[model samples]
Target chain A: MKELYSLSAHELQKMIAVGEVDPATLLDAIFDRIGSLDKKVRAFALADKTKANDRLKRASEKKLGRLYGIPILVKDNICVKDEATTCASKILAGFRPTYDATVIRKLEDEGAVLIGKANMDEFAFGSSCETSCYGPTRNPWDLERIPGGSSGGSVAAVAADETIAALGSDTGGSIRQPASLCGVVGLKPTYGRVSRYGLIAFASSLDQIGPITKDVRDAALILNVIAGYDEMDSTSVDVPVPDYTKSLTNDVKGLRIGVPKEYFIKGLDKDIENSVKKAIDVFKKLGAKVSEVSLPHTEYAVSTYYIIAPAEASSNLARFDGVGYGFRAKESADLIDMYLKTRSEGFGDEAKRRILLGTYCLSSGYYDAYYLKALKVRTKIKEDFDKAFKDCDCIVTPTSPTAAFKIGERMDDPLSMYLSDVYTIPANMAGIPAISVPCGFTANGLPIGLQILAKAFDEGAIFRAAYAFEQNTDFHLRKPKL
Target chain B: MESIDSKTVRHVALLSRLSLSDKELEAQSRQLTSILSYISKLNEINTDAVSPTSHPLTSLKNVFRKDDLKPSLSTDDALKNAPAREGDFFRVPQVIEGK
Candidate 1:
């Protein structure tokens, strides 16, 4: 057999379950893969080889849980007891959590070995990985391009074989966009479907922790492990968790998919359009009906998301003042100087930009004009999706406008950066489940992702539809030569 | 309809607690103005009677549990690695003064 690192998470788990392979051997292979590729990709922030070995030893003793020694990478934003959870920001450079996040506890209970914390854009603000206090994560496909972000490290790590699967928090396309750019699968579960007890907040309402993996089956497996209600999180849903893997069978005979006309408009790249259209054709081939649907509020998604996400972000990040947690200025002339200098130095440019925009929108004089108005528009966006769901089991769109661009291409243009999320933001705003699956590559060899969104708590529909598409296409089977 | 100027940029920076330099303010002022103008397209849509939603799901009730004091992080453990720390507390410059 090939190196264990070369296999998908599902393949590894199945082999281990049948006693064809041992956890020790797989753990060593994972360590070796991380040692080789992580320096170039800058995938992980903190790794404890000793702890990983301990977990493997337990697995060998037959004391292992469901995941049983599968090497997993966690986004730096999620808290793991006794490990640094920096969120890739200087503000929390050495901060460590005393208690594990609820998801971490659940994963540990399943005997999944956490290999390390992956890097991300500081405070989960940037769409590209470039804004991390540590550094940018490079795409495995093309070293010169980005793996979409702020979950870029998690996405890049899986693509580069540093880990078979990883956890990422999605707010405004963070998980799905990076997965699209990196040519992997990223799932953003419905809001409140997973516990937010340990995730450092970026935008509480929009954020949900989900999985990014090499394949759809692996995403389903990870979702089953993490999705549940938790007493620790006030926003957690009380719904019963379903066996996500059970829905992966290629049986979408009567599923109806809606392709929004607004998403195929002029700004979308022709290559991406073709790739998604081809994916729809694949769905049609697999006994599903694909029809054109109108979502008129699509144009307002980017504008509304920018306003609403940041408005909430501005409030959530208020806890990071110099007085409480995170960074404080070295020497301050006065209280005001301390606050100014600490925040000025603590946050990256993107974080500051959002904070300012959010603060502007939420200011007393502007609240009724900007923030409140944006919320009303947000309702319309959700209503549009609610209306569309009446005719379709799931909605389909291009995960992003184009494949990964050159490193510095959109970094300097804030509006252009915002435009990158045009396709995926509405799903977050609507609190629906969405998955980004590889569809095809562009003429330039960059991968395109087909995004599938389902109604609230209907991740089963998303998995069934995505699995159907994955089964009908060869895109998910392709791997980066590197 | 809106063009953000240096004054608005300064005000926003103050609100966000960022100490932007004059150079940054000059550049960001133009950038913010363009973004705000682009988003002002919302002004064209008449939404007089529609109620704004703060959360996506309106059915969510207050999901809080009773505040119980579990084991707190020891003061030493909490402040051990702080960049700037004082005895049993995080030392910061005074934040407010008496009127």
Candidate 2:
């Protein structure tokens, strides 16, 4: 018998609709699975069964919304009113948000039960989950290897069947890269397709909340619920929310797919390179019109992102001072002393490093040289996508240059870690939508991700391509030995 | 040609309102030096003709809501997460040199 916990959100929804499965029994199975495998995978910062049960009881009494009675894990950075929403950093320790993030509100309004708080990089600062205060979330495929992050815990949870689906925030590959490494479906929607009202701000401009799920259809299902305009977020676009499931039909025939030649470079792992190339061939076989394209400015994505993301992060993070919420240093002699001491003690090394770097970029005389110059380069990056998208319905590339590395391998090397985001950052830069799907696995069994990039608010195209590719392959069906 | 030395790092840390120990400052100086050096590569691209993009969607403008009072968060809920609270306010260390 297929384990109840191993089923997808759609499957669970159907079973419950037919009265073949009880919602409470499903929750019990989910928590039971998490109870056993989480010690090895370490996917959550907090998995409160008590609170989930309370939510389950309440949800049972509600009318059916799209995701009725299905369990979902939310990234710690997204606020769940009256529940701990720490961003896996000590600074926000003991902080429970006073209100729900719009996405959280949307999910629960659809009868989706919030199961747990997923672990992440401290303040979403690092590429590896190692930077989180709760320690690293290991990849289910190989516990010794790292799960690509800062959404590592969310992705690992979904990959390990810890939950039916999860919500994660992507600020330059936090969602896609980790999804790639964990061999699951992750999508970063067009910049404003989803509201960012209650998500803890990282780099306000680059950060977006997206779904990390077991397959592309689930991604579409979650996006259907969460993607829409809200009065709360100014950045959210006033676009019509399409029934994304309608785009899930496996038909890529005559679709224009762009293959960026720049992504095939020396540093990309041979296995990943081959797997992505193979994914392209699969697309061609399915009648996708594939041809070489150039995103010439791609070389500058990481450097440009470092300048812009940090500058905004430094500004956004200024809110974490001791006065209002979260950790506060009590012994300080005065206000300024308290601010400095509280921040110094509460933040981890990576968070401190990013704060310093961001401050330096936007600081005094260096602003024009670093910050302004980066913004100009960002225009070029956006233009590259614009010119390429003119002829292509979507673009394809490896989500990361390499697969999951050892946990501590790049922790000491921040630059190397930053470069891993090279392929995934461009979508955020252009405010375009992108998805990462299971393309193949490495020789040692770590999965590789095939990323698809579609134009702004054209997430329907991404869903189409990703769903088609997923249907034509069995990579997503392979489970970890755990 | 700019490099991040300890003095520069300390100044930046101060600006960031973070108090770093000497060891952390030294390590930060080294790491920031390398990171900033890497970021400087943007200079290679001739972006003189391009306009800077602060946000990707240039179409979005100012967003406003109706000028009516809604049922906002109750003071108790607002102060619920405050590390130090006094009655309806968040209490903090004295500012502006007390009288």
Candidate 3:
């Protein structure tokens, strides 16, 4: 029998439901794996063995739901009541949320077991996980390289078989980029498709919670549970969420696939470029029609994201002031001093950098010049997608310009780090659903991701295409030698 | 376009309520200058006729919940994460200086 840790959530679910494996036995296998390998990967911020065992014991006795007894890792940014929701930032080090995020509640309702919290870029700020206070999550493919960021730890854990699957939040490709680098399947749902009621805010407009899994089927299964309308989150759309698993069909014949010209630019590594081109060819072989499409405003996506994301981050992060909850300075003389000292001492360099940049953009004299202009250009970017989608059902591109880089390689240079998200940012900007799946590997054996994007609220289209592509290729079957 | 400098960085940090050391200000000023210069590329595009979109979904309606009372966090749970608390309230440094 295959080790329980190596199986997908769906596989585990089937095994547990058939009386082949007990929930506690599976949890024990996953925890034992974490104990052995986590010292090197640094994927989890906190893994409460006692609490997890308690949940496992209780879940095994009850009637199973869709994900019965399946272990799921959650990013620290998503609140799990009474558990540490640090967001990999010192500002929230000891803070335990009073309530669970809507996604967590829904996942638990479907019988998913919460294993632990994954590490991430502090406040989900950087493209590399190095900014995390807990420490960077190393790539399972190459231990020396980074696991990509914001959701790095989530992807890393799933890739290393530390957890069956993980939930990660994406703001400017936090979920997808890491999923790409770590060689896992990641999906960023259309904005407002999943409720954000208890997700610690990074950038309200851009932030979303999605799944990082070993395969596309598991991604669809998790989405089925988390995607829905919630009255608590005003931004959540009331549109009825279809059963996502129904869309995972093997037939993608005659599906229109758009190849965006803007994504295959100069800076993209030749290996990644060739790998993505080959993935496109696989779609062609599978009977999908492929054609080139243009998104002219693509060049401005990273720049615009930098402006808008930070502007919202500055506002959302303002709630972490000393007065309410979270970290407070010990020896401040006054309120102003307290605020300054608390934030300065608590936040990491990347968080401080973004907050400062946001403040500069939204300042009295520069609001129109920076923030407003970015928003206008954002509309142009969205219009480009709108125009392209008229000709095609989905767009295919490389998830990241290159395979995972060595840790600290670009940490000193923020612009280069920001460029790591160049290909994934447009999907977030347009509020479209995008998924990253393993397509190939580099010469050094690092994973490459092929990104598939569809029109807003058209996650079904992406799933049909991704599942077809996955079935025809063995990329998703390969596991790291960890 | 205006150039960013250490002084400008200090001013922005103050506005952001984040205190930075002199060394951090100097380093961040340089980085911010480069990043801002790069982002300034947006100004080259012709956006004169385009309207700003604050959110991608413009057709959303205001969502309202029932007016009836619902369960909420108790005082202890609400203040559970506060670094300092006094009698079920958050305690902070005094704001008004004058007696």
Candidate 4:
């Protein structure tokens, strides 16, 4: 029998359905693996075996649902009732939600055992996992390098086999960037495709919750469980969701793929560039038409994202003022004084920096020049995708400009840290669906990622392309020498 | 682009309902200045005729659900995560002015 911890969620589900592996035994094996490895990987923020067992007991009695008995982790940013969903920030310390996030409820309905909460950037802010209040999650590939973030813990957990799959939120490439760095599959669905009812808001317009898994088919299978409209999230579109697994037909024949010339410019690591170009060749050889498309506003995406994301974040984060839940200040003379003290003491440096920047942008005088200007540029960014997609079925690029960097390499220079996400942020800005799958490795043994993006509601194209690529390569099959 | 100084940082922090230490103010001033400088690169693009996209990619907005008294959180559940609770209410900081 295959080691339960090492198999994909779908494979494990099949075994559990046939009674070849008891759900509790699979749970114990995964917990054992997490026990041995998580000390080095640090993927989980709250991985209590006792709590997971209790949850598993509850899951066993539910009606037979898809993905029954499979273990999945949730990113700390997404609320799980009776569990701490801190977004890895001190401000949210000691807080537990009374209700689950929409994704959590969906997974519970599928009878999947909710194992734990993965760590993340403090309020999903930084690219590397360093800004987490609990500290950074190290790459399973190399313990010295960082697991890319803000969904670092989710991707790392899947890579290190701490959990079979995970749920992560992407705002400006949080999910895809980490998946690239960790050599796993990460999908950021089209905005409004999945409900955001209880996801702790970061950048509301840009955020989307999606799956992180070991393989493309697993990604599609998990997407099947999570994708759909909910009245609770007003932004969720009431579009018909097709069976995503049906789209995983290992063929990309006649598919039109665009290789954006703008993404292959300066500052992109040569190994990643070579890997992505080779990936494009594979698509071409598979009878897919490839063209050198241009997304002219590509260079401006980072700048525009910095402004618009922070502006929205400032407003969304205003709720954490020591009023309803989470941490509160010790003593204060007045209401304003308490609010100030609690926030000052609770939030980390990155959170404060962003809050100040947002406040400055949305402040009276600068609103038109900064906030409104950023929004206008956002329209142009989206227009760039709209034009490119008109000429192609899907677009391909390198996921992160480079593979995972050494810890503390970009910590001092916030701008450099922000730049690490340059290749992955455009999808979020355009409100499109994107996926990252392993393509190759660097000389230093670091994994490289090939990103595939499609028009909104066309996640099918991305899955078809990615599955075709994965079927031809052994990259996804290779695990880190952990 | 206007530079972020300690005075501006302090004022912005106050507006965010967050008080920063002298060190944080100094650090944020230096960091925010550099970030804003990078964001200034957007000034090169001409967006005079473009409109803002403030919502999701969907056309749906102002989605009003049918007005009904559906199941809501019990008062105990609502106060579950609160730092402190006095019966049904969350114990917040003093809001009134009088002693």
Q: TM-score of chain B, candidate 1?
A: 0.81
What's the lDDT for residue A341 in model 1?
Answer: 89
**Per-residue alpha-carbon lDDT of model 3 for A261-353, expressed as tens digits?**
988899999999999999999999989999999999999999999999999999989998977678887898988999999999999888999
* Model 4, span A1-482: residue lDDT tens: 66789999888888888888898998999999999999999999999889888878888887878988889999999998888889999889889898899989998888888999999999999998899999999999999999999999999999999999999999999999999999999999999889999999999999999999999999998999999998889888889989999988889999999989999999999999989989999998999999989999999989888888888899988999887899888888788998889989898988888888888999999998898988888888888898999999999999999989999999888999999889888899889999999999998999899999999999999999999999998999899888
Give model 2's TM-score versus the native structure. 0.99
Clashes of each: 0, 0, 0, 0
- What 10-residue stretch in candidate 1 chain A is worst by lDDT? A55-64
- In terms of lDDT, the poorest run of 10 residues in model 4 chain B is B54-63
| Model 4 chain A: ten consecutive residues of lowest lDDT | A55-64
Evaluate candidate 4 and give its CAPRI docking class based on DockQ: medium
Off-target runs (Cα >4 Å) in candidate 4 are none
Cα lDDT tens digits for candidate 1, A50-142: 888986676557666778879899999999887888899887766778789999988888888888999898889888888899988889899
Q: List candidate 2 segments past 4 Å from native.
A: none
Residue ranges of candidate 1 with Cα displaced over 4 Å: A58-62, B66-74, B77-81, B95-99
**Per-prediction TM-score, chain B alone:** 0.81, 0.92, 0.90, 0.90
Write down the C-alpha DockQ for each prediction: 0.60, 0.88, 0.84, 0.80
User: In DockQ terms, which candidate is top?
Assistant: 2
DockQ for model 4 equals 0.80
Taking all chains together, each candidate's TM-score versus the true structure is: 0.96, 0.99, 0.99, 0.98
lDDT of 2 by residue, A1-482 (tens): 79998988888889999999998899999999999999999999999998999998887788878898899999999998888888998889899888899999999889999999999999898888999999999999999988999999999999999999999999999999999999999999999999999999999889999999998889999999999999899999899999999999899999999999999997999999999999999999999999888999998999999989988988988999988899998698889999999999999998899899999988879998999999999999999999999989999999999999997898878899999999999999999999999999999889999999999999999999999999999999989989
C-alpha lDDT of candidate 4 relative to the true structure: 0.91
Chain A: TM-score in each candidate? 0.98, 0.99, 0.99, 0.99
How much DockQ does model 1 earn?
A: 0.60
